[model samples]
Target: MSDITIRHNPDRERFEVLDAGNVIGKAAYKEYDGGASPQRIFYHTVINEEYGGQGLAGKLATVALDETVAAGIAIVPVCPFIKKFLTKHPEYSANTAATTPAHPEFLNEPSPRARA
Candidate 1:
């Protein structure tokens, strides 16, 4: 089994999962200045095809959400994968916004994964 290391790269606005020094997955988000606190809108998650089926996505999501909660930053799970992941892991729900807009404009924007 390969050891996976997760790290938050704020400059790139993403949490990367590395397998032996190679990036294998990422969870992307956009940050906003929320007055008294910061907010993060998670918009995308991707794992290399070769790294699929290894539960790396879940691991990435766990770390990303965990860190955001630790920092007291509100989370807006706009990405379907993140929404679903949060649904399955209800413990992290407290870190999310009380009410996310039904349709966020950012959802319509093209994601890097989509552009690829």
Candidate 2:
């Protein structure tokens, strides 16, 4: 497999993961400044089905969360995938908004859309 590179495209409000120059996955987010601090809500993540089960999703999550931390922006993980990833990686918790729950149980709860 070719090396995968993750790049943040603020104009698109998402992070693109490219494999050998071709986009294979993307993590979409929305920026908000209505809170105490600027934050990004990671609302969706998707990878080409062909790229599934290869850990590409985890890699994309890592890059996206790392960039959010570096920019001092809190993260609201509305996407179950991202929430689950963060649950396993507590180091990224510091970058989450104060209102975000700290327990994995809360993070793992299914969203309304998922429940339906």
Q: Name the candidate that leads on lDDT.
A: 1
Candidate 1 wrongly placed segments (more than 4 Å):
34-36, 98-103, 106-116
Worst 10 residues of 2 by lDDT: 98-107
Q: What is the Å distance of residue 88 in model 1 from its true position?
A: 0.8
lDDT of 1 by residue, 5-66 (tens): 99999878999999888888899988756435678889889999998898889989999999
Question: Each prediction's TM-score against the native?
Answer: 0.81, 0.81
Those runs of model 2 whose alpha carbons end farther than 4 Å from true positions after fitting are: 98-116
**How many Å off is the CA of 84 in candidate 1?**
0.1
Q: TM-score of predicted model 1?
A: 0.81
Question: Considering summed lDDT, which 10 consecutive residues are worst modelled in model 1?
Answer: 98-107
